[model samples]
Target: MDKNNLTPVEKNKSPLILSIVVGIVLILFLAGGLAYAFSTNLITMPFNKAIELLVPEISATANPDSSSIVTITNPNSTGTIYYTIDGSDPLTNSLKYETPITINSTTTLKATVIDEKDNKSDISTQQFTIMEKTVEKAVETVVPENSSSIIIPEEYQGTWHSIKATGTYNFSGNTYTYSSGGNVHSGTIGKIEPYGNSSTILVFYPIEVNHGFTVDPGEKGDGMIKIDGTTYAVENSDVFD
Candidate 1:
C-alpha cells in the first residue's frame, strides 16, 4: 500500500485515537470544575440545608368554673418555656413554667420558649378573661307551707340580687321572697345543712302557688343557692324596710 493513499485501516485508527484524546480532556476539565466548586462551597446546596433546631410552641387555656387557674404549655419536649404577664415580652430571666397560673381578672399573658440548641421560638400571647360568677336565682314568692323553727344562719337573712339578670330576693326570719323575669317565687327555709367549711344549703319549699317551680337539690352552697351551676348572691339588703 502506498503511503500517500493511506489504507482504510490506518485512517480509521487515527480518527479513533483523536476521539479518545478529546474525551479524556473533556473529562479532566469537568473534574477540575467540580473540584473548584467544592473548595469554594458553591455546590454545597444540599449540605447547606442540614437539619436545624426547631422552635418551640405554646398553648394556653382558662378554667371555666373558677378564676383560680389558667393553663400554659409548651408542646416541644426539647425546650423550656418562660412566661410573663402585664403584656410584657418574656425573657430568659422570666418566670419559668412549672405549674398552672392563677388569674383572677382580665390579664394579658405572653410566653416564649427556648430549645435545647438555644434556638428561641417566636413569642406567644393570649388574653385571658377571669369572669366573676354572677349569682343566678329564680323569681318566686315565699310561702312557708311546712313550719319548723330551724333557725337559719344570720348571714342567710338578707336581700339578694341576680348577677346575671334582673332579679331580687328578700330574706327575713327563715323566709326569702324573690321576683324575676315578671315571675315570683317564695320559699321558707325548711332545713339548713352544712356543706363545706364555709358553705350551707337551705332547703326551701313553695307555698300558695306551685307555678311548676323547681328547687334544685344541688342548690346548696355558701350562703347561696346553686341553680344551674350558678350562685345567687344573698346578702343583707341595703334597702331593707
Candidate 2:
C-alpha cells in the first residue's frame, strides 16, 4: 500500500506500539541488573541485618610458665558464646563460654555466638601457641633401712576404683591392697615425692605378690601418681572412676 494511502490511526499505531515495546525492554533490563547486583552482594537488602548475626572475636593471653588464657567476645552482648578447643565447629550444645578458657597446650579454638532470637553468627577461629615448659623429674630419696614404710597422705588413704584397669585399690596408712582378676596383692608405701605442681608420686614396695596375678605388683619402682587431687595414674593408666 502507498504511504499516503494509510490512515492517521494506522500511522499513530506503529509509533505508539514501538514506544511501548521500548519501554518494556528498558524496564526488563533494569530489573535484571538489580537482581544480579543483589545476588552478588553489590547491594544488600535492609532486611538482611535481621537474618545474620555478627561474628565473634577470639583472643588469647599467653603465660610463659603456665597456660594460655583464651577469651571470646561478641559485639552483641545479649548472645551466649559457645566454643570448642578441639578444632571442631561450635554448636549450641558445645561447651558454653562463661569464664575464660585455660589452655595448657597448643590448641585451635573456634567460637560462635547465638543470640536470643536463635540467630547464630559465623564461626571465629584462633590458634593459640603455648610455650612448652620443661617439667622437672621427681627426685627419689633413699629410704632408711630401719623404716618399713612411710605414712600415706590422709587424702590418699581411701578405697579408690580404677577407671581404665579392672582393679580396686584400698589404702590405709602406709599399706595398700590391690585386687584384680581374682588375685590380691599387698604393698607398702616406701616414699612420696612431688612429681609436678599438682601431682604426687607414691613409690611402692610390695610385701606380698600373688604368683597367679599377671598384672603389676606395684613394686620395683612402679608407683602411682595422684593428679589434680581427684585422679590417680597407675602404670601409665588413669585409675580413677
Candidate 3:
C-alpha cells in the first residue's frame, strides 16, 4: 500500500505510453521540415517568388564640357548609391554619389536604392549640364594702312590710334587722344567725314582736300554729288592726288 499510488492501473498505462511518444515526435518534426523544404531551393515556401528586383542604371561623361561619369548596369540588387546634387532626397550621408561630377552651372539629379528587404528606393532622376558652350565670334575689323596724309580706307593706312567722336580725333596734326588702342571700344574710331555725309559743304576746299568723294570736277563731269536729294560719288583725283 506504500508503493505510493503507482496503482491507478499503473497510472493509466503511463499516460498511454506518453501519448505514443508524443505522436512519434510529431511525425519526425513534420518529416524533417518537408525534407528541408524540398532539399533546399533556398526557401520562399508560401507559393513562389522572385521576378526582377532592381538596382542598375546610371551614366555620364565629359571633357571641356565640365565633367561627369556615373555608371551602373545589370545590377539585380545590392545597393549603395544615394545621390542628390540639387535634386534633393537621398539621406544616408547623401553624398555617396560616386563619379566625376565637375559641372559649372545648373545641375539637378537624384538616384537612390537600398533593397534587400531593407528596401528604400524611389528617388531616381536625371538632369544635366556642365558648362562648356562657347561659340561667339564675329569680329573682323582689319583696315590698317595709314600714311597720315589724311585720306583713308585705301584699306586704311597705318599708325592707327584713331578713334573718332568719343575717343575724339583731330587727325593730321598728331593729337589722337584715345589712350588704349586695338579694335572697337575703350575708344574705337573711324569717321572720315561721315556726319551723315553732310552735303560736303559743296566741295572745292581743293576738291575738299583732294577728292574727298562726291565730285564730278569737269569735262561734262558726270561724276556727280547731289545733296538735298542725296547722291554721292568720286571717280578721280587719284583719291588723294
Model 1: per-residue Cα lDDT over 1-241, one tens digit each: 6767997898799889999999999999999999999889778768454334343444545556756575666666667888888898887888898888787778887887776556677887877776788875444334344765545555545666665657876668866687888888776655443332323333444344433222332443444554334445655423222
Q: Please name the candidate that would achieve the greatest lDDT relative to the true structure.
A: 2
Off by over 4 Å in 2: 1-49, 135-241
Comparing 2 and 3 on TM-score, the stronger one:
2
Alpha-carbon TM-score of each model against the true structure:
0.33, 0.36, 0.29
lDDT tens digits, residues 157-192, model 2? Answer: 566556545667787877778787999977655545
- Put down candidate 3 lDDT per residue, 96-212, tens digits, no spaces: 755545545667767676544555656667777666678765343332233233443221222222112112111233112222344331212222343233433322122212333
Task: Report the candidate with higher lDDT, 1 versus 2.
Answer: 2
Worst 10 residues of 2 by lDDT: 210-219
| Regions more than 4 Å wrong, model 1 | 1-68, 133-241
Q: What does each candidate score in C-alpha RMSD?
A: 15.2, 15.7, 14.6
Question: What does the lDDT come to for candidate 2?
Answer: 0.68
| Pairs clashing within candidate 2 | none
lDDT of each prediction vs. the true structure? 0.63, 0.68, 0.47
